[model samples]
Target chain A: MKYLLYCIFFSWGFSLFSQNKEVLYGLDETPQALLLNPGARISNSFHIGIPLISHLHFNGGSSGVSAYDIFQKSSVDINTRIINTISELDDRDFFTTTQQLEILNFGWKNKKEFYFSGGLYQEFDFVFYFPKDLAVLAWEGNANYIGKKFDLGEINTRGDLLMVYHLGATKRWNKKLTIGARAKIYSSLLSFSSTDNSGTFETRISESGNNIYEHLISNINLSLNTSGIASLNDLEGGSATNKILSRAFFSGNIGVGVDLGATYEINEKWTASASFIDLGAIFHTKDVESYAINGEYTLDGIELLFPPIGSGNSAPPYYDDLIDEIEESFSLDSIYNSYSQMRPLKAYASLKYNFGRPVGGDEGCDCLNTGENQKYNQSVGVQFFNMFRPKGPQFAATLFYYRKISDYLTFKTTYTADSYSYNNIGLGLVANIKILNFYIVANNLQWYSNFAKAKSVSLQMGLNIIIDENK
Target chain B: MKKNLYLLFLFTFIAFLFSACVKDTDFNQTDDIALTTVLELDFIFFNINSQNFTDLGINNTIVSDTTDLDFLDSEIVSENIIRADFYFRNTNSFPVSFLAQYQFLNDNNEIKYEVIVPVQAGNNIDPVITEFTEIIENNALVNFTMATKVVVNTIATSSLNNINGNLDLQSKATYYLRIEE
Candidate 1:
């Protein structure tokens, strides 16, 4: 039997993520709703968030295999379960995570139909596609993978931490249409990715006269690009959330973006709305470090030779020469290059049927068609969510019911289907007690019944002071 | 007083949500890639003219030209690959068996892997040139982190004019990478 061997020394752990706030779309009464749709329905004259308590949100989910798929106790071997899980996942499957904290938020309405708002918030987004080829190689080894071309293009992911400073204006053009636009300055603190890689890892018999087979690494250009961690701690560099918060504002890398949204009344009972948010990009130039390995090599065996340090040559440092030769073949280059990344753009659209605003026990604004306020206490609607991702565009369809329980409490429930889960149920509660207001939104409610099996989960909560004047 | 109570409740709810978040466990896996290219070591070791000389009272002795090796210096020089099967390719025109030895050295001129293997002659039936690898049981030269060079020495049994056996080294390097979140 031919004895083939190779030597490789080191690697580092890195990751990426992405985002979408589905539940908050089209829920206009809460101040946070303006983030999703700047032209969302509003009945208040002024509003402000309670310092750090204004808004806090985090979302994470995997579209492919859940923890229960491999970890749940089963009669089958754990290795077999893991293999099955890997088999079930493909390149299209991805993991997405997002975290956001609103530092400041405030809005005020004009004497007329014009309203203005502005806010500063920190956001972190990460997403990475499952490298199925790598998984197959890991579980089965190259012996069975002979002749199969495991593609390296499947290794695409992106992660970023940034601060978004935004200001927006909403104007009621007429009795039926309200439009809004938001301008934002994005200051990126951290960015990391190894996207658009190209290569093929394959194994086959030696082309020439030899008993050994060759594992060919052809046309590989795997790059790891990162920025914004110069002053971070050595041991707890990327993990300390407090460190990230400390560097949230005024990161050297900055870019500009815009959000546009509009709400229109199709008729007396039918209302439709659409919004396109995060249409921007951030340029990373400060503290940038880019690493690249772009080349090819072939290996049949590794027999490294070294000077005998002592008697009998018990250990010869092993494969130092082979490692050197492979390094020659597949060179790694480190450079400081500036790059720009477009925001993870998302689109939202909704169509709702209003049963007319319920006459509340308290005296308040009741202008139903002015396009500046809502007179409906109950409504049913469907919202379509689409987020631009590295692999492709992911979509979700949501059907929701909303009810106003007096003037102090309103509840909304939604059923959704997306790439992550088919039975995603969401709940949102908005409490408006005079000037004091609080809201909480949670998606994938059914998963709470079995957290271990959940493919996705999201939560958002906020507190604000609002003033709704009845004319 | 009602507003104060509402604020208290909101603060409590926020506290509860934060507490509930705790820590989430995420799992991920990744594998590295390596290319195994087989180089006919004969190309580097077979640059010799047929030798015809008597040495130490022995007639018709054969010797091969020395082929110098210089491993390149790049950051891809890591020691993380698993060893597997390897073989030697033989296309030489020898009619009889012989002895072949290979000596590899590091930058500081230290002999790391030394092995003497038998070579089978080419024939109409049997395989030629038995494979020669650094058959040291101790994995001494497996994790070498420095630059290296290789030299091959051989001897023929028959007093022939064209005594030659080519050397081919099949190279295979594996990369292992891990991704954690």
Candidate 2:
């Protein structure tokens, strides 16, 4: 039975490889190559084929203050006010900044057939922020010891990982007309941390007949902390961490989509292709967890009360003494937490053209030498193949232009009013060595838009390997 | 085709497992308490006929050396008593319960005589008169009489004393009344 299952899997994979023969490399327009080029497959004779591609594409400018950030800022201000009142301070300052490291695509593609291919890709990011610097001061009174200062430091961390499966195929009617399509399956894992700390000091002044006669002071430090790791598996299995972090639930949904592309021979020497890609959504089983933590302290003569911290089934009482002291002196009340989720859709498209022809010469190459080639090689005096064919090997020079129609195409949550056009203008040189069944590509890219004043440039080079048993 | 079926089965299993294990708990609801305001009063008083109270036809009458003085028949005497009653009622709300305590004060700015009745459930209860007493001293002829009628209940012609004070009457007096139900 196990062998039978293995044979079936092998046959399925074998058929996919036999389908993608013609294309040297799957196009870069779609993150899900297999989904876009479902017909793409390894050539008939080759047992295996591999293509390593690197993409350095950036879309969307810096996100403005997220609704979460706005809420966090307001919460911080509120917490600060409560802290100040409890400490009897005239002024206080607090600061926070959130950072997210997003990875959109990272994976390897395998050809299963002459016109078909499939693979998996990963996309995710680690998001965290250290909201520190809660500085407070007690006003100076008649007693020299009437004022003191302290800081409350807190850090928050959260992240998630997404894996998507893609199936694609490529079809070539002849040497000049080629088309492709692909479909994707998406899934993800998520987790986060909830922890905070606070410190406090007491300032006291002796009053004689409505006047301050002397001053006394004391200091108390308290820390409230809670930490746990949670995952989709754990969440589903009723893990303790899941309960502690119920706020962090991660689930994924399957969405169906198709990528369409067509490459045409403009002439014997030049070819052009346009593709609509990455146009799909991941129906989420549930929203991702966004969390936050807020803490405060108060001072009364000789005692302090650190804020209370609660998680799942555990509530710490180490700060109880401090909290009681402060409450009796100067009351404190405050709350803090961070929450947010990402939109599930994204869309993209590109148009490109190659300006060179096949390098090796053959009798059938005469087609390239026809009058149709004159338009691409003016130096050849309309002789076609003589001017278009490469002397050493077939190489192509290419240029492309691409843009995002709407950021909101994927999920409405991704839309922004500052939305503007993103354009990429680049040059690429491709060398095809038919005998070795491989190609080398070098490219220089630049991306810019109305959103930013400066343009970002990157240099990329990679090799494409194709194995064809028929050759 | 079997591979596709297996893939579908795998996904369904994962979904079922996830759905069954995940738990969502709701927060408890809390309610806020509301407060109401109430009114309170301190004192209420009314005094009439400081002297010769029997001038008004009553059981208590003083016979002088010459004849029985028909003080009640004298226009000036009756007019004086009427003026006092009018002064008390006009100076404040009738049933005195209708007015708040702060409304009364003489030119001297002293609250010598005052009545306080709380306004409960949109209605005011009149002040209760708790004591009434009269005494005469010296050779001066004097009499004491009083009449009280409150909400259909009447106590009239109540007399305390009648005598001659050789000099001006010097006596300490007191009166009392209470609201009926």
Please list, in the order the candidates appear, how each scores on TM-score for chain B only.
0.52, 0.18
Candidate 1 residue-wise lDDT, A31-135, digit = tens = 888888888767677899998889988777778766556445555554566667778999999877788889999999988767799999988888878889986
**DockQ of every candidate:** 0.10, 0.01
TM-score of each: 0.74, 0.29
lDDT of each: 0.65, 0.27
For model 2, what TM-score is found for chain B?
Answer: 0.18
Candidate 1 matches the true fold with a TM-score of 0.74
Q: Identify the runs in model 2 with alpha carbons over 4 angstroms from their true place.
A: A1-114, A125-160, A173-177, A191-257, A264-272, A286-464, A468-471, B1-181
**The candidate that achieves the highest DockQ relative to the unseen native structure:** 1
Error of 2 at B138 (Å): 88
